[model samples]
Target chain A: MTTQEDIRSTTADRHGFSEVGPDDTEAYVELQQSLAFTRLRSRSRRYLVSMAALFLAVFAGIVALMSWTSEPQGGSSVAGIDLTLVLAAGLLVLPCVVTVIHLVYTRRRLDPLAEIVRAQFERSRR
Target chain B: MIFSLIILLVVSRLGRARDTCSDFYVGDRTFTSRQNGLALFGTFTMMTSFVSLSDQIAWHGRRGVLLAAGFAVSWLVTLLLVAEPLRNTGRYTLGDALSLRMRARPVRMAAGTVTLVVSFLYMTIQLVAASNLLALLLGLDGAAARPLIILTIAGLTATTVYYTGMRGTTWTQIINAALLLTAVLVLAGALLVYYRFDVARLFGEAVGGATTSGRDLSGPAPTGHRSPQPLEMSSQVLTVMVGHAVLPYLFIRFLTVPGTRDVRRSVSWAIWLITPYYLLIVLIGFGAAALVRPGGLLASPDQHSPVVALLAVELGGVPMRMFVASVVFTTIVAVTAGLALVTAASFTRDIQLNLTDRRDGGERHEVSVARRAVVVICLLLAGVAILFVDANLTFLMSLDVTMAASSIFPALLFAWFWRRFNTVGALCCLYGGVAVTLALVTFSPAVSGDPLALFPGADFAYLPWRHVGLVSIPASFLLGYLGAVVSSERNDAKYAVMQVRALTGIGAAEAVTTSPALAAADGEPGAPRSRRWLPRQRRQH
Candidate 1:
């Protein structure tokens, strides 16, 4: 396993932002604390937390809906299927659709923020 | 028997010379999203889902539908909470991922302990179920035949894992998924045709038939002696959803995907495949309840025999039975192989490698150690399965899921998401959560006085709830929070790096090019002509 210092130095080299020499460990620490990195961290954290909250709310809502509704039994039929069966099918499919939408939306929204952070590191190097 | 032999041969042939740790562990991280998706689907729809869901649905009516629906929700949990971040960590095992920013040795040790415990318990269930089914099919019922059947199944599972590693296992899972989906689709189609594709009539007949046997289809079905309350039903759903989020085997699936994006896509694809499969499960359960008479066709109405009976009736003749049996057999082997591989991988990569300082022995040595670990772990699990052959399988499965939810889920969630989560907190969650879960389960009614208890004669009942997830899951999170708050040690910088990597996929492990053909096409400098599979550690760090 690499030391923490080695990891930091390696990351700096990859990002094209090793303004500080490898020997200047304190300067490297300062680089990680730069405003750009701080913003990157804060934005990503906010995104993840918000996504988590949204998913939890949706999941809880589904559970509550199931609990509140009367059990599907001997119900009216649509194309020979019971109403309850259709409801269960909808419940099963809803989360899956939500997950796909969430992933696509999050990827589109967050990738650019990651790029901005990377560009900032490069700008600092120049 | 012929089908089993053929599957074993195919899997064995595919296990050709995985010379590097990356190849053995993650298939050189070369699996595309679709391939990984299929494998994930295979692992997710284990024999438990294949056999138990239909059985539960047939027995409990709407409650079984809810149970199946709850399992579908688990994939959503995996996608929303676990998959992307876990892939971003870019570690081969959960232990490696958790220990990335925390104290390495202790955290790795604790993670490895949880992995082995969960894997062993889960694998034992698969093995015992397969052996029991095999014995029943062969008309063998004596105590003497049971161990022999277990040894045979375990030996086959171990051999597959020992030789194939991840690459072979991936292909095996793909094949299993295809076979399973085909069999299910055919049976489901037959059922639909039999009912003339009338959904209301199908369910109406199911409810009618089930009610004739003194079982309620409109509400929660009787479980042994007691009907499950709404709270207990909800708890089961919660336990399954949370339990799947931290299952060690599922974590390895994320490692197989190339990047966080592919990981997310892979899980989405898995859910797409699984949602329809479970809808079919609901259909099959209802079909079984309606078509197969309660006590006429099957010896016991509640057993999985109804599914076989349904297939026998719909498809007709002995060939149908053999075909359905083959599908079930393959499900068992594929799932058990995947389980054993994860257990062995964790044992080799996390516990053995981290505990010792001799980490310099190249990829070949590590792969060798992994193969040996696979054999050792399989043998140990088989021995334990032999001892508990008569134990209630359902209770054991509930215990396994509860353990994962109460112990592993909280620890992994905090380790990845919470900034203040430290080594002390990780260990506290691991040991404390597991200890409390085991103690509660031991005294709970499920194990103490229930007829399904491991020792039914002994009476030590105290706890009211059969499942401990309602309490243990919350208690675990609290314990982790308290431990982190009290700890004086802080590693903010390391945590910062972890957070960045996990969120941005920066400094994550890259896919190594293992195929010489691809490497040549890419025009790499001084690349080896022969097969050279090496870890991308330099780039990853």
Candidate 2:
């Protein structure tokens, strides 16, 4: 087991904190948070089920496309491949627009995760 | 310890090794959003997709690239949910999240092990690609493939880890990104010029004329390499293309950028970057399709693919040949660098954090261990590449992609979005998906049949008719989610809350400047030193 100093004490600063001392208390939080990223206790079944369902749904669609097309038989474009090229060429003028739109929608959902970390960090700092 | 390595590596590198270890591997938090966008553009030319997508287009007509488009969508998925959250939640490595959130050392170890193993397989593809290109260029016996690849690229990778570390890798990738763009434009432009600018007409002609055996071309076939049908998917094809393409090496590449927004932008830009490159590959494939007709073909056009041979005829000179060779070489090198760095970082960060996170005082050991871990991981990749250089590209990419799609992608997605996701679920789903897929692939009639059998009949199809992806991709996700539910009984709400905060970008990191030589717990634990590295205090909370 590592003793108190390796992690318990704050790491030395290169140009020593200009106007700051190593916050020993803040230092303790780092030790805890570092573990926070690495530890994996377990998961809830419901979540796993949901992920499975989503994977299945998308996969089934891929299969449906495969079977529905009925072999790589003809000179037909499967999976909307023809359309993909069309869209890709258009994006040359505007690379990030579509992805940006989707990212914004998801950002709201993810932003709250950050809030939780701040709240925990603040409380622990006390 | 990494900072020390960076100091040593500045010479061989084209750029400064000024970035911190995390910055070198994951990019400095300061990596511009624009650069991140370009970085994605450069790196996402995944190995699995290269041949599968190209062959699909050759056989299935233009719709083949739909698979490519499907794979590309993941980058967008990354931009929206994963880019910022993954960047925000952790400082280094996938193991960081596992250890930090669960406080489980074993879990971090398990994740790190998977990362290293998967990377080893993925890296082999790049090494083999380099070897093949060199063999083609040098006019050497194809049998010399393994030695050439090991001597050149392996030596480079080992030295990279020893010297430039992550900084060297990033700069190399950046240069490749630039060269790849120019190469793509050049080849695409040349093809378009030859076709008189009507790509659609060329496609229509290729599709209209495509035959089962694309054997009508004039070029000499490489000896001992012939299959009856051009469109056939042998068992080897299924394994390489589907399995190898989606592996973690590519997925992990996104983290090389500095920040979330940059990653987001990079993801978006990646689509633009790779889209044309692949689309141009179609033009190249169609050129082969057009030039190499059935019945008169000397070799299946896919083998020669006419990209290189045609360049000689079209440009009619040495400059063009050199350019073509350089472009192909760069593609291999760029990809190799990306794969090697991903492996190195995963080995370093994952093992370092796992050993130290549980123990309160393990920072220095963690750093030392991470460096040593990189050495071991790169060597392992070199060994695997040496053994498997002759395996068909289609088989290699298939196995790599399918496993990645089934396992790593699901884990990362759920880890980011699925709140209830737990380790048991992730493990079960990933292993189940991969196992079932591999078994089906084993009995794939096309692959199991003798290469020169008179009848070529199979006992049973075993696989569900076609592309094993249809089954395994979903199976993996199901197992992961279900595994989570089973493990939910050991619910750790506080841990979930912490994860949620991290994903939301509200997490804060205590700025660490330099680690002391030895801590106070030691006989003479040095007092904490200067703290110039801390970010200015802000009300982020």
Candidate 3:
């Protein structure tokens, strides 16, 4: 199996592009020094999961509040405006919650997506 | 408050580089999608979404969805159509991406002028929004508020230049994204509490009376006028919306990321961020429908709009005020940083890179030039914004983006997908399409009319294809391919092959390449090297 670095090099050579690793970007390096952009290097799975859950909870709360609360000013948007609320609550708002949760989880899981980006950029540069 | 100040101060004191002379623009070119996307979102959450949309609800009632439609689709197009292609094609700045396939110096120059004009005009609009929001929210007068806001904006832009440079912008953007997410949710929650929200009843109330109860209600909206008044709003809305939006902000966001996937994903996330936030605005719009009416179309909603007054003038005092003020402040800060970074990047990566040839310039010199350019660009934007005040030149310039997107975007996409596409055809289609859009919006009443009126058939917006994606985009590509086919130029298989590899990550662009196309020099971190490469023989004796 080719390591990411190997993939990184082969891909870089193909595109007539230059090497750009995480260290290549001053901001990414600096931000990595900071906690915001950096991924959890050695945290227990529990911490990552909890943070993910918290993000989901907050997203859900916002969706619930919007769909459940916030009275309409007056009148139907479509032939039946009530459907919009149901849809917003069920479809729009709920999906939003789910999507956020999914995205957060996927974002965490896809930490290797960075390599993919590195790989892809390397590819594109050629 | 002190926390943020300390952060900035500490970063400034890091002894990295006072001038941000090298790293000020593109950073080290290592940004990822998550980081860059958040930053782009932060920069882009301008008066349009932050202030204007909330007020739009109060102004148009449910009709505001027209604006939402315009905003969402544009972003969608950005994500799906342009993002990866741009990433594959560009390095450094938006202007660089734009001028890549075209060799005509005049074209590059035009693209630069457009970028500068659009960036300043757009930045100015946000500034005005900042000043107005401060006065209305903080109870300051226009005289007191305007200068204070400008100074703060200038200072923030300056400090951004001083620190991690473009990298600083990404960090600031993350902060902004966090703040914005919190603010919009809290406000949404607050509105819910106010209405005691009965999902079905509220809709009933709106349909029955609230939306059109008064003489000012534009006749009975509750009457279920199924077919929008069909005012031919499609084109007009498309024109102004495209005109005012679509340029500097996204292009600026480009420099923050590592590559195309980030451009696509981050932009996609931005759509999610924006859509939900605007849904909150819809929450606010409905909030306004029940609470107040907005006067004057396109007027400063922070004051003139009743939503602002109610949210402030009415109940739930200190917490609301604190939250709103904090959000607005963060919004201003994040947006300012993003704008400053991109402006600097455009100068270095695009204009400077091409003008001086990036290959020979000193990293220190390039960074210094970018830093100075940052100051000048920020000042110029502020001045232009102040001069225009309410003109909303951003709306006009945004038209260029859509024009670029629909016309140029399609051709560029074809260049990626179709091996047959030649540069000559792409240029004709790109330039022709751009010219058509400019003519329609500037010379036609489409610019004058509202794009969000009643119907698409009667769209008065200046853009050639208002809402229908079916026709405008394809025609553009056809024009491009036909132009290329008619000309004697070769298909640039080499360029196409390289682009394919670049996008697929088969090659990392950051790696130094032998391609004459990449003019950025190497060695010594944070040092710009373009000017140093300016053939020494050409220099005056």
Candidate 4:
């Protein structure tokens, strides 16, 4: 039968798990549940889900518009471009703008929480 | 041929310094975000995008724009939900990340199986397409030369992977992406100039030609060739989006970056490039419809050659055609090498290492094993490509995407985000998902009944839908949740640790810093010392 030491060593070797002593496990758990880490994770998840929903809505709208409307008549023109062409181009550019905005907003919101978590982790390690 | 030889030589020379498994597999985590971004771009824009997207657009018209949009949005999903956490896991392979909070052996085995299946299917499609393109370019006819071409491409790809590994592959991908972008931009620019940059006139010409051929430029025509149903379009797009989230090759990209921030930056850069590149693809497709004679283009044996190659020929003649062909060839070579490298890495790191319990193996031994695996996998793929040379490229690719979506994506989502997910759930997700997808696809119209089915002469299909993602994707998620809820083994403590590590780069793998000063300057000495887990090269002293 494998002893406790053997099990710990095997786990460390195979899975790259650091050997966390009994004394450190409590601290590790505390650090994991600390407000900073939780806040960071929750905020990240909220932002990701909201952005995904928004993009999905845009995609659905584009598909609906394409399907519901008839092709633009020959007389319709935006500058030299056809009305249909202009609309399609606008639809295509919309998502890129949204993605950039989401990225910038997410970074601004979450970076501080991440920094706090990092500082907490450093303290726990000490 | 000379270009391939030169690239091989350059890659081999560059790989000489890759003495450790870390270096071979993840570039020792030293690549800048810009370099990784270019590699990511190359990985996403595989040969399928080069060859198949134009044909799809030519066939489907405006509906094909949805497919391109779907491709771009898939990368957005990856950037938002997956990239940062995946990098924070500090794992070299998908199996590494998934097994972090679960029972190692079983989870690793399940992930390994899924990776093998998806990568094998995806690689086979690339190889077959490459072989077909080679035969066409060389003026070879009949079934006899096809196998030879497949073997040649496979052999070349395997050699590149064996010698250069990930580091070499990354640089090669960067170069290939540059060449591919240049080729597409030139073709698109030429076409635009030909139409004098008048979008209205271009569409007008396209509609006229399409009408003459009894088709519609804007939407589905009344002719027998109807547009894809909305559900079908949605299923295809969903499969691609979810598949992008869990593909092993893409996961390997995260490991090449030093931290989560770089991972986010790298994917953002890739999106910035890929978004515009796809827009250009739409232009080129519309240009093909507008500029080429409908009957003439349709009459060509290779449907995409006129759109991709002859358009260049029309403006710059023989020299431009040669340049475009070279670009296509480089793309196929670079992508095949990258795929082979990831497959070998997964097989070695996830399967072989786990099964043998050979953690004691030194860096040299593991590197050797990876090289040997690359050779074996390439040979197997070559044989499979020869057997399935006549398979429809789109069908094969869709099968790959379906498997990825149904098996890997659900499991990865739960593994990364769900606190309640356990090993049993993961197994169910991987095995049940693969079984369900393969069964559904085998009975779907893609395999039979339809004129474009894999075996068109056979009439065994009973399933109404051609693509299986609509049912299989949701089924995998349900089964995974059921398995998790029912299992007796619950490890909330382990999940907490994993969640913390994934959210913050607390215990993620660090870059290999040889300088003691740098290691000292970085706080948390214990975390940096864990580099002992990674086998290092012996010092020359």
Which one wins on lDDT?
4
- Per-residue accuracy of model 4 over B128-164 as CA lDDT, tens digit each: 8877766665567887888987777788788777876
Better of 2 and 4 by DockQ: 4
lDDT of each: 0.73, 0.49, 0.51, 0.73
Angstrom error at residue B190, model 2: 1.1
What TM-score would every model get versus the actual structure?
0.89, 0.70, 0.67, 0.91
Scored against the true structure, residue B196 in model 1 reaches a CA lDDT of 87
DockQ of 1: 0.28
What is the CA-based DockQ of model 2? 0.11
CAPRI-style grade of the A/B interface in model 2: incorrect
Number of clashes in model 1?
A: 4
Across B1-541, the per-residue lDDT of candidate 3 in tens digits comes to 5435843754553334324332455554445566666666676665666666666555555445445544544554454345555665565554455434334343444455555555555567677667666566767775556666666766776676555676566666777788887867866677677667554444454344453444122221212213333233344344333332345556655544554445556776776776677667666655555544323222332233436445543445766765676667767766766667666666565566556555555566667777777778777766765665544343443454446454645555555545455556656655666665565455333344443322324535544332322334455667777876787644242333334333343332341212232223222243222221111111111
Q: So what's the TM-score on candidate 4? A: 0.91
Instruction: Give the DockQ (2 decimals) of all models.
Output: 0.28, 0.11, 0.06, 0.34
Q: Cα RMSDs of all predictions?
A: 5.2, 10.0, 12.0, 5.5
Q: Score residue B460 of candidate 2 by CA lDDT.
A: 52
Candidate 2 on B231-251: residue-level lDDT in tens? Answer: 232222333333433345545
